[model samples]
Target: MAALAWLLIPLFAAIGAGLWGSWANRNRKTAGDGIELAGYTRFREAMEKPDAVVEPEPHSGG
Candidate 1:
């Protein structure tokens, strides 16, 4: 009985892992690009714009 219980531990663990994996991989976005990809593309476009510029402020020493 003790040996059986020990063996069952791995069986349960495997079952739980399989269930979690399936749940995680369940499909959703079959259409256009995903949100992260779209956001990254927009960010890239904004960064590439010439009008967008950054100016640094001068620091004063005490």
Candidate 2:
């Protein structure tokens, strides 16, 4: 009986969370602008080699 009460805590929490999320998004509107308002500027590609060395000029065999 006590163990069942403890197990139902998470179930009740999930129900509450779902209700809150639904209510929060009930009257939401989409933004059509092409810009993001989060102001995040850092951008990086996946698995890009940052330590690569570049040769400014090619060696010519004389």
Instruction: Tell me the tens digit of each residue's lDDT in model 2 across 1-62.
Output: 99999999999999999999999889767674434533323233323538667767876868
Q: Name the top TM-score candidate.
A: 1
Query: Against the true structure, what is each candidate's TM-score?
Result: 0.46, 0.43
Query: Which candidate should be chosen as best, given lDDT against the real structure?
Result: 1
The alpha-carbon lDDT assigned to residue 34 of candidate 1 equals: 84
lDDT of 2 at 4: 100
* Candidate 2: C-alpha lDDT: 0.73
Give the true-structure RMSD of model 2.
Answer: 10.8
Give a tens-digit lDDT track for model 1, residues 1-62.
99999999999999999999999999976766687799999999998888856787877866
TM-score of 2: 0.43
| Count of clashes, each model | 0, 0
- What's the CA RMSD for each of the models? 5.9, 10.8
| Candidate 1: Cα lDDT at 61 | 67
Candidate 1 at 52: error in angstroms?
17
